[model samples]
Target: MAVMTSQALWDFGRGSGVVALVLLTLSMVLGIATRSGRPAPWLPRFAVAETHRNTSLLATVFLVLHVGLLLFDPYAQLRIFDLVFPFVGNYRPFWQGLGTVALDLMIALVVTSLLRTRIGLRTWRGIHWAAYGLWPIALVHALGTGTDSFSAWFLVLAIVCVAAVLGALGWRLSARFTERRAVAPTMEVRV
Candidate 1:
């Protein structure tokens, strides 16, 4: 097998990062939808939950590839330390640091999820809330450090991801409010 070129690694790294973001967005939207405890138009509730879990796992895999490729690519100038400690890298430290923070959160989420049976639902849920913060940090890191951030296609992809997450969040909130109102006791006054 021919050795991989630096350019190949760079390109692969970028592609993996983009794929991870898309998967992350999908996971986020499905997670929000799952909370409603309702089946999607076509998929059952269990299927939606399974899809959410699978997408999240796939995103994590792509993220690992993205970071691994960048670490090997001399152009990225990323060290293992940079991957763990936030904002210490020589290249675009702040932006890279954001990625580190997101990674840490992802680790926490995955660990907690894996141990959910041992840790119990309340603890797992509290840690899982980090997912809400992870997507945007990863997005900002991509925009700040990504080579294609200004390119038309990347911009469009970013916009669509943002819109999808925001739409899901809005829907979740509205559904919660509607549910609460429906269940609230009404005061009956006869004067």
Candidate 2:
């Protein structure tokens, strides 16, 4: 096996981090779509949910790669402690701290998801709400600490992810509101 260089590690780490972000963004959008209870133009509702689950798991895998590669990369100088604790890194502490927080949330989400059957839907769902917090935290971490953050391509990617998420959220909220309104009882007021 060829020995990996510092630059290779950094490049791999950066690449994995970007892939993870894209996957997470896709997962977030699919999750919102799943919650909306609407079938996609092609996929059934269950397929959308399944896709969301798979995307999230894939994102987690890439995230682990990102962290692991960075940990070994001499340039990053990431300690194991930095992985768990927030705002205590040698490089861009605050941004890396947000990453730590996001990692913690992801851990919770993964564990809860794995135990969802045993934990019951209500409890699992409560912990799963942390996902809502996870995406933005991860996004900020990427923008703040990403090596290519200032590049035009990266900025456009970031903008696209933001737009996709916001669009999904808007659709979910509107659907929910419409659903609620449809079921609401009519009140008769006599003056």
Candidate 3:
């Protein structure tokens, strides 16, 4: 019987982290699609919102696994404080700090979402917008801290993630513009 090595756990942690990132991106794109209020041929607006919520929850699960594995991995030597404090770790402090910051942002987003009814829509919305910041921070954390950041496959993944969000954002803007145009004629001078 072979025992699991620290390297194996580290690899698993990294893989989970990458998976979480992809899920996060997908969640964001779905969220943007929901805001567009225009459903695709396959998915309705409500389904998009449902997927967004589910994907985010799934991402959170993977993120927990990623962090848990790293904490237990001897090679990582990551302390609990390192996970939240940022820049205090023995290894790759700056890059690790970015990950910590990204995690912090995610925590806030999740907490606020779970309590949105109690928090009030306006307050929840204000905090929820922080998710936009989370994406880039997570991207940079992956690039700076990831072992495969520069690899072709990883680069492709990153490009796809960025493109997905950008495309969704563009679609949303266009939809909003179309809505405004549709309402414009109704507001025209009437005899």
> Compared with the true structure, what per-residue lDDT tens digits does model 2 show for residues 52-101?
99999999999999999999998889999998899999999999999999
Of the two candidates 2 and 3, the one with more favorable TM-score, higher being better, is 2
Better of 1 and 3 by lDDT: 1
- The better candidate by TM-score, 1 or 2, is 1
The superposed Cα distance between candidate 3 and the true structure at residue 177, in angstroms, equals 4.3
The residue-by-residue lDDT of candidate 1 on 1-191, one tens digit each, is 22468889989999999999999999999998887777789998789899999999999999999999999988889999998999999889999999999999999999999999999999999999999999999999999999999999999999999999999988887745332112467899999
Candidate structures ordered by lDDT, highest first? 1, 2, 3
**Ten-residue stretch with the least lDDT total in model 1:** 175-184
lDDT for model 2 comes to 0.92
**Number of the predicted model whose TM-score against the real structure is largest:** 1
Work out how many backbone clashes candidate 3 has: 0
The backbone clash count of each candidate, in order, is 0, 0, 0
